[model samples]
Target: MARELEEVKWEKFKLGDLFRIKSNLQLNKNSFVFSENGEYPYFTRTVFNNGILGNVHYLDEEHKLKGNCLAVGMIAMRFFYMDKDFYAGQFTKRAIPIGFSLNSRLANYFITVLNKKSKIFQSSLVRNFEKVFKNEEVKLPVKNDGSIDFEFMTSFISELEARQISELEAYLVTTGLSDYVLTSEEEKFLEIFRENEVKWKKFKIGDLFEVNSYKKRFDANKVNILEEGHPYVVRTALNNGIRGYLKEDEEFLNEGNTISFGQDTATMFYQEKSYFTGDKIKIIKSKYKEFNKLNSHFFVSAMSKSFSTFAWGSSSFSISIIENQEIYLPIKNNEINFEFMETLISAIQKEIIKDVVLYTDKKIKATKKVVSNK
Candidate 1:
């Protein structure tokens, strides 16, 4: 049996008319704070990861006295989204519904729709807040009885979420094993080959590769669906650290190139495909034959972890340090067979692709169920 798409009536509403955008109150560094095991969770802008927080900052009695703080089910919109409530911080624009109970699930759905519609909120920086606010409008669907189907909507989303989490877990396990296999073999070979016939030579990264940065910028409107052979890399893709070419604006980067994050506080995993984005990302072309032997995952793991240490503790350190950093390599004419290593890596990559496809299929099936119910 099929549930027919019902003709649902929707009311047009300006978000500003029904919601009050609250200004964030800053907490002083000197304020009293509680330990991790505190009485209440301190809410902040970062708490808006899909409208839930696993861990929260804490505030003491005095800090809590400062009024205008939100309670747990309050609808928040950090930025312009359809109706999804997001936790607001000093940086994000917060919204409070005027006369309705905060329906967190409904709000999340609206935000998801808005995100699908535009990419304005993808970046933390607000470039055109005024324009975005003025142009945005939300449509509230009404049931036959003129009331929201809160339970049905929530259940619909919950099913999808549960399915996604399961698929993600499976994907993680398969990829982790694949990575282990690739890294373990690469390490074993390097140790054996390096010791036998070659004297290790140290060289700076800049001496072996041509580092380039793309200067052209594209707006959200200019981006297209990620397809093969298109240039795309952004902060979020780097954050995903998946191996595959991303679909993005054709004008963003030079065709057929590899990129790595250079500036993020968190280490990004390397993927086989290019389509990554981040401010501190490095784009490189290897000038040496050994450069092809440089496994993307191994290199990114080393750089991200090392660079993050420097960024957190030292102000003078920059990714430019890579240009001067020493790397130990085997002598050119030695019996080190890089081609054999590449073949092993390629096999590992194929296994990863198989896992990704399996996970993707599960996700698609789950998505279909949710969409059908809707």
Candidate 2:
């Protein structure tokens, strides 16, 4: 933030002017379509778990319960971002963005800002939300031209995420933490990217990987009966979908060094250890060769860009669909440039590790000084 938040210009905008209020699906936990292995999120007024009650499948094809909207809980005054198609329970409503797309980052920022206005709400549930929100004004940053500064909102959120890893300038070498800084190789890579001169080639996922599906899903609720052993992966989009560590079943334990993808939930994580899953987890293995952890990071980025569109409708992101999906990767001499990915990720990790090393060193020094005083 170059300027302080308080220093930024703010403008008030009515909610009705920004979004159209739509009724929720009006489904409950016991709806006939609800399933533990369902495709879309079922939102409710609960103040926990992002207001999601559960997931459901086999929804009405003609129903207009779409994602990319803000789902609001009137009674609980809860707000949640629906990035993918979801079903809304009773007493909830959707805030469909009128003119622009609400990317996840922007939506999250809005949620935080919107919750600040919770004090104005009354005891009555906002059943007539359209009329209520029509007069509701939310303050937002505005440009000199009086337009909402969407770019600032996105970049601020992005910078916050990057700040978690710290600023970069050094690289840790063997034996000790050495400040290598930016090497010529990295400078070249960065320059090419800055100039938009990097070439890319499209590769079909099925051509590069073998997609295996584990159908026999162990229930997370019932897993307590088995002796505790391995990780129990599930379909949630959070925490890499690892519900908990459960006892491994030889028949269900998937091998390590594989990409575990939630068949319907669209959650993905590289399984560094052999783990069991709850159900419908698609295990992806590279057909050419095993991708290392660094390379898997590149793959995950590519997969997200290509597969995010799969959730725009009622289509299931099944194994077959994943197989046929094509992702773009950096190209060198018309071939997939694995070296570039490896080098880029390696450089980034070294920089991050340097920050950790410096932080730990400072902490150790402070502790030593305290001990000496004692």
Candidate 3:
């Protein structure tokens, strides 16, 4: 049985009273030796990836931060639960419950409530993090006797996890992605890939696609925003660069299955669905008809490689400049090898899916135990 949120008793408590918030050891990015199999996570101020920039080699005793605590990036107004010891980065803080233990579910509940105040904590007020945030109060569910209701919080999260686990199980079975075994053809293709046998040649961006200059100017504030609307594109490398949803305007809508390139940031993402955006963007549609979803992934990787040596992040690129840029592609007789692109992408997807299946299996087992105990 679950208690509805509306039916639960609530009480307000100052954030400072509930937890001890302290600044994390600020470390330089250059000092980090990052590795794929690193022992600690390097937490950054980014709202993405739960504030983790990447895993890094172990630091000294003073640098190591234990888990089972809330990691806060005050500047970004993001809160994340760290389940293991890791390294902290710039503008980071650690919040530990006062005279209380925080498990994953409990930490999630607290973070969910805390993040509701995130909208007001902008860059201008970042310097007043402790003064402004520590004094702020948050509402939490309580029992009739006035104690905080940890049981209700745990139950709510457990039920949510159970539903997600069931959906994942169905998805794995229906898609047949649960079986991670590699096929004979895939193995052969990988061997050739390992040998670096793929043909490579450069092709100008302008020659492969038509760079469209949107005829009309777009005003974001004037646009009708909707809950269930079309994607409003932005200049970012995260979340496919989609910032929000807006009422679909046929006049402003850019075609689907195209790449949206940010001129100033040089960030690019393949737009799977039709989207609309403002300036500093160049929507490019492929000249060839075979540039579908799978092939688009391969092309995006190649497009990123094109900008790597061009000092992409720090530099700006105009439509004229990007058009002249060339990317190396797998070619057959000096033509783009669409067949090879599709095959390589398919194998890559399966390889990634194997890891996801393993994670889903673990979640399902854990969720079942939570449900059974209830």
What does candidate 1's lDDT look like per residue over 1-374, in tens digits? 12122654666656556556554454433454445554333345442543223222543343332222222212233333223222222343445556664444555655565445344434323545434544567676656686655554565456657667666667666655424344565555545555674454656767765666644544435444344553345445343543234455445654233544433443334334445343555555666455443355444544454454454523323447656665554444554344544544555565556676666668667666765676
Q: Candidate 2's C-alpha lDDT?
A: 0.75
TM-score of each: 0.43, 0.50, 0.70
Which residue pairs collide, candidate 2? 229-247
lDDT of 3 at 84: 86
How would the candidate models be sorted by lDDT, starting from the highest?
Answer: 3, 2, 1
Tens-place lDDT per residue, model 3, 1-374, is 49987799999988888888878888888986789898788887888888898998877889788788988886768789988898888788888889789988898888898888787656446678777777889988899999889889888887887897898899889977787777777777767778999889989998998888654445667777555687778787787988778776577788889998887777789998988886677898999999998899988898888787765556668777888989889988888989888877777778989889889888998889879878
User: In model 2, where do residues sit more than 4 Å from their true spots?
Assistant: 1-182, 225-228, 351-357
- What do the candidate models score in CA lDDT, each in turn? 0.48, 0.75, 0.83
Better of 1 and 2 by TM-score: 2
Clashes of each: 14, 1, 0
Compared with the true structure, what per-residue lDDT tens digits does model 2 show for residues 83-103? Answer: 988777778888888777899
Best candidate according to TM-score: 3
Q: Which candidate number maximizes lDDT?
A: 3
